[model samples]
Target chain A: MAKTVTQEFTKGLWEEIAPFRLVLGLCPVLGVTTTMENGIGMGLATTFVLVCSNILVSILRKFIPAKVRIACFIVIIATFVTVVELLMQAFAYPLFLKLGVFIPLIVVNCLVLGRAEAFAFKNKLIPSVADGLGMGVGFTLSLGALGAVREILGTGMFLGMSVFGASYEPFAFMVQAPGAFVCLGLMLCGMNIIGSK
Target chain B: MTELIKMVVVLVLLSSSSGGLLHWLKTQTSSKIEDQQVKFVKGPALKSIFEGSSNDPTADRFTLKVGETEKNFFVGKFDGKTNCVAFEGFGKGGYGGDIGLMIGVDIDNGSVLGAAVTTHSETPGLGAKAKEDPSFVSQLKGLSIESPILVTNDGGKINAMSGATITSRAVCNAANDAGKIYKEIKSQLTEKVKSF
Candidate 1:
């Protein structure tokens, strides 16, 4: 049974969310979510690359030899990542500075490669585009949510504004490395519970 | 044979086009990126060094060729006189790598105005103090540009940050280099400052 375009797109939002469900591309998912702003910036950059690579891969799927398909997909992804890096540096220097090395590292994001191989390589242009956009938006929302949780609990602040009053003591650990793991685990557990129901 | 040929052709075409596109984009954004770097990275140091200047030091700047390198010199107007110039110097032997120091000097008296670390990669809470803690750079104020700068360990007046002697030495080294550059271009700098 073949799925419709809407089904393909919606699946990424909850059923196959990259970080939580697919468990793909954990490096950036964990590394950049210390702050909501950084998380969103990184997610959007990745999204740009994902959408571009998917479109190109879908268009050239016929010509790409099976043996060298991965290599071609990487080249496409890398080109878009560089484009994002240059544009970000030119227009959003502060956010670019915060995101730093992760922008370049997006070229190696497993989610992008996985999508190229699994979906874009076999699908038509429109569905490939929808898949890319859905996955990208899903990744962005997950990072943003995770970052908000971490920022609120760790610093008693939301996007630099104090959420808890002056009396609230922040859980500094929530902003640290170990905190990322614990928080992710709990979120994953919660997601699973909701998913099962 | 066709399979190999197709793969090679596809790769070459993709790589070359990618290169061409990046090159063009880089050229287009190069100037904007430079402005951003100066605004964010070097802007703070220049602001502090030229705190009371009548004009914006970043906007009022000129570049001069010194030994095959074009170095930017920011002009600061004080009391309607533009006799102050600030420039950057790099110090080698830092813990992480070379450290960049922005030194401001008064052309008339040949005295130091202020100095700040523009870029550094030293350990946090230690060598990084050169950039973070103002007291270390404050000691460099008002010193004559003609003499070489050194830490107290080297029998000079400036004191090194505790447990960060290497970083402190690197900063002093940068100050000394800036002084050398200043003396070499003193006459040319005065001429340029008058035009500003």
Candidate 2:
């Protein structure tokens, strides 16, 4: 089947959904999803890096020698990550502080590298951009959902505002590491259920 | 050998181009980035400590060369005199490595006006509570850090934050260090405040 450019973009929303279907890039997924804000911030940052790296990698694929391709990819990816890091630090210092080490850690995210190697290196520019945006948005949505669920359960709030009422005690486990794993597991299970239908 | 040389050239070209691009971006945003650091990261702590001063401390800030590198000093003016300063201090936390806390010192009295955690990476609910609990930060506000500040666990006056002894100790120790640094550079700081 000849895949349309739209397919490249939309598949990542669910079919090739990351941290679920693809099961890639779980580090930030589990670590930074303590708040809806953190989750969304991380998602957007990843998307920025992914989109730029994908487009750059696709443009330079022909010029790049296969022998040193991975190294080349790393350099390009690292540059964009640094740019994001600096911009975030200057303009979004509060979010930057909240996200902490995870911002720089985006450089090593498997999803970014995987796209660079598997798709961008072989695709045309428009499709590569679409794939980056689609995948990045998908990743952001998943992480944001994880954060929203965790924050609501853990703190009885969404984005730090009271949600479940004063009488309801927050289920603290949702914000902890154990909560992250369990929540991710249940989410993946739910995704499986939907996929089968 | 020829192929290897070409590969080296490829790597070099890619690295140089990326490096150049980053260098340019950094130059464009460096000032704004510095402005954000003051406005957000360290601003709250500075405001909390230097509250009600006649002059804006952040705007009246300066840098002093200490040890090897330069350290920033945010000055608060009272009655047109720069009398207070705030700067970042580092402490070793239990889990997430270095903890950064902003320390505000009264230049004349040599007392810590107040403190706020600018950055930390300890366990979220436990060690992180150190930052959340205002009392923990307030405890250091009026103390004379002439001697090393110790938590109750180490047999001193300050109460260690519940369930976060190591993080508590780290912050106290860092605050104590800030005091010592303040004492060490009192004369030099006084001279710099004149410029501010």
Candidate 3:
């Protein structure tokens, strides 16, 4: 039992990591990972929503009827997303501006709703929360790595600070939409090779 | 019948409580949210334009209702006199969406103290240059708000930003729109400074 509980949490970190492994929540994973700060901001925001929704969904799992459960879960998830939105606007306004549309779009992130239906509904609160945290951290790290790669190559800057010296010309293509796919694909390939052994 | 009633009870209880909680949270945070909005996003533009003000315009602000929406006005105490105020209004930019502009006007003279593009969705490296090239926006400074604001391409006083005539036009249109609002509400807005 103890081993299984830890596995549930650790599995989300690597074995079933989102975007790269499970291929979930690609909208944000592709859209906002243009900058390192934006990636971390978006990842943390989604994680907050995911963890909160997972915990609430688990707690209500027994009481909610199986038929109307999806609707109930949506309401729960949206409530938390709204809380995040308001809090972001209040305190973290600059990051909120950079991540304008993606924040509210968390309600439909599939990852949040998916966890509610897939894992949290079937599990107890502690494991549900742990799964959420692990998955969220995994997603955060993945996005951060992607954003750093894109920012460095595309803008020739890391976190807005110039890299490779002033003489080097940035391959601006890495910041555009097509660059996102190529970068993500390469990263996935690297992850696959590393994980195989 | 019992199952149907149970469904109704569960949904009603959950939704009503969620609504109540959200409403309370909004009330608790709306003030802070508005303050931060002005400070983080809007303050720099207002401060940059209203530089001579003795009072921080972001802090000395009032809201005026236009239709159902409330518009924020920032007061500037230029030379210790509070006759200047700033506000952001929208103009349709290169795209179909609204372009936000922060405009400062001398209520006494009706001349633009300064203007800046606070937010926009125009094409980067072109239309986005309107915000980057300070000279493009500086052209509007000291122009009488009574005259129409427009890019020279459309037979106006302002020069069009090189490759971004559309965005340039949008900024002019936004400034003109803000000017009209300032004209109509100038009396009410000036009254706000009386207590200051």
Best by lDDT: 1
What CAPRI-style quality would you assign to candidate 2?
A: medium
lDDT winner, 1 or 2: 1
lDDT of 1 by residue, A1-197 (tens): 28888987888899999999999988898898998998888989988898999999999999888989999999999999999999999899989988888999998999999999999999999999989999999999999989989989999999889998999999999989889999999999999999899
User: CA lDDT, every prediction?
Assistant: 0.92, 0.88, 0.88
| Model 1 spans with C-alpha error above 4 angstroms | none
Regions of candidate 3 where Cα sits further than 4 Å from its true position: B66-68, B153-155
In the order shown, what is each candidate's alpha-carbon RMSD? 1.6, 3.1, 2.0
What TM-score would every model get versus the actual structure? 0.95, 0.86, 0.93
Candidate 2 wrong stretches, greater than 4 Å? B79-81, B89-101, B109-112, B116-176
Over the stretch B36-91, how does candidate 1's per-residue lDDT look in tens digits? 87788789999999998899988888899888899989999999998999999999
lDDT of 2 by residue, A36-146 (tens): 999999999999999999999999999888999999999999999999999998789889988989999999999999999999999889999999999999999999999
